[model samples]
Target: MDPNEHSNRLSTEFISLVEKINTLSNRTRSSEQPFLGALEQWRIESQQTLDSFCNEKRQTFINSRLEELNRLRTNVEELACVQDVTQQNTNSIKTSIDRIEQDINKIQFNFRPLLIDEHLIVRRSQDLLPFPPSNQAIELTDSSYAVLAGNKQHLLVHREPTLCLLDRQLTIIKETSWPLDDISDICWSSVLNRFIVINSQYVFILDERTMVLEQCLTSDTVNWIRGTCSDTKLYLSTEGIGSSIFEYTLMPSIVLLKEWKSPVTCAHNEWIEDLKFHNDFLGLVIGRCKNNAVCFELRSTVTLNCLWSIQLEEVCSMYATRCCPMLNHQWIVVAFRNPRIFHISSGGKLISADKKCRSPSNICQIGSNLLAIWDQKCIYLQNLCCII
Candidate 1:
């Protein structure tokens, strides 16, 4: 009764103790699983943070290097332009030197001695030359020589942010300050009796009499090179990937008609230098590198058909072109480098040339004479022709 019962009871108690220990171990294992999961999640988040920081640093370095390279490239391009201009000036000086040398050689070899006591009186007369007398000139403040436009009665001059209307005597009759950012070019429309002013982004129409801003028009393309207006439409020259002319009708509602591009093959880098319109013809002065310029005339309407084209020579710079209405034959005045003026026929023939004006930038017909601005400061009134 004593030994067997005691041994059985001890065995049962040992078995119970084993069951309780197993339950405690299972609970401890379950609790440790959640802690281990939380620890693993923390480790993963730390790794992601470190990776993101490293990527950010790498991208920043790359962007900084790209910006620096772009700046350097811009500087190099500027240097190249300066070098080209320097070379051009050097060549110009060399040509002048050669001309002077040739003149000296002619004087040395083919000298003609003047007769003594013979009075040689050179008669001065306006009939001898085509240019009119330099009657009036007025200096302006930082004016662009390319901003001369108008008819025979009034001359419109743009002095940046301001426009000046002058009389035949080169006196400023009216002055109006432009409210826009800048003005790239200006033209007068006799039919609309308004002045068209253009910037790179917008075109502004102004009343001729009151000189008040009338209407503003915008274009999809940027960089408007020049503008011209007819009786019923306005023509704009815009330059981007290529050169193009955008036409807008000036009726009840301003409507975009169409865009015109030159059918003539042009280099991808070609740009428009100047634009002019006369009668039913539109003239475009296109330029590339120095001495690479072409004058083209096409139909002034939406349907562009090339009538004539002429490549210009000895033109270091081509700035502006104007159609002359007083002449019987179609003639346009083209201003070239060193401010030389050339009369070009519609058929591309080089007519009379004038190099008397210093740094002529623009030309227009005023009365029976040609009015031109020189060096962005002085204005000259010269006869269109001296022959009777």
Candidate 2:
């Protein structure tokens, strides 16, 4: 039987036992369905209110302007019939014209087209990914691995046996073993054209062309769990609760630039599981040590202030979670314990709750068209056309 089978069955039975009657409030508290339904109703009501207001104001505008319009027409008819211009009639016509112009301007402002954009109209979809992948799932030779795509040219993966640099087709171009200690997380530095790997406090750079791994020792001590890079900065997350995140320079040499402590990095009791950098912002996946409560926050890289945050799960067993940057300024977060995938919008809203039927451990978007998913059984490299 599956490891969680018993728990799943018991939970379902317990839910059935206590569900005497389905009340709106109780059901609403535990699930988002009711709130979503309410939001739809609210939107409909809001649109109806707007339509009613516009229609009422429109009729009122027409009613108020009809008398002025009639007077203007009468004055024009009278002026045309006179044919000869006198100062008194000329002044009267000028006054009527001025009033009509002002009325027209007000009418134009009130009757303008609706102000809305494609961004607001685009509906959020819970579309399952792979969208039937451009190609089949390329099950890798290794059961478990670390895969990352920084450049469009190559993909990197490390297993217990060796570190492999594969081409876009997921074919191994070159392979190497760790020079010193085992590297934990891998990040790509586009500016450097290199991959940065972390082994706790130690830092290393690997060249895919020759498959060589070398250390760039900062000689500092901390629990570095994950690493990701921007054009200029290298961001690393720590392990254990109240974990800290360190920022380093990718310039002259790998040097400490700044340190983000607890409460700044995350709540004092929570830890950062994964982090990704995109468009001058850092995305942090914060998790708890005791339960499966997880949060994905988008923050400003300049000030480290949270722009927005979303709670992915309320209670889950401590499991590894990963965040990948997808096309169109969005995120893909996968929780390994429950084997579920969450697609998030660039604005920190949960776009979809896609459930993965496999026991996949982690996933990554390799460039624009490819996605890599790895587990204890195998690795899957699918197309990202629709996933994004």
User: Where in model 2 is the C-alpha error above 4 Å?
Assistant: 1-147, 289-291, 314-318, 386-388
Candidate 1 on 47-134: residue-level lDDT in tens? Answer: 8987998799778756765665565556556766784566665565566556655654674434366343323212222231245557
Considering summed lDDT, which 10 consecutive residues are worst modelled in model 2?
117-126
Using all chains and alpha carbons, the TM-scores for the candidates as numbered come to 0.60, 0.63
* Reference-based lDDT, each prediction: 0.65, 0.73
List the candidate 1 regions with Cα displacement exceeding 4 Å. Answer: 1-133, 143-145, 262-267, 296-302, 316-326, 367-370, 385-388
Predict model 1's lDDT versus the native. Answer: 0.65
Give lDDT tens digits, candidate 2, residues 78-142: 88788686888878878887887787786555357877544332323446452343344445555
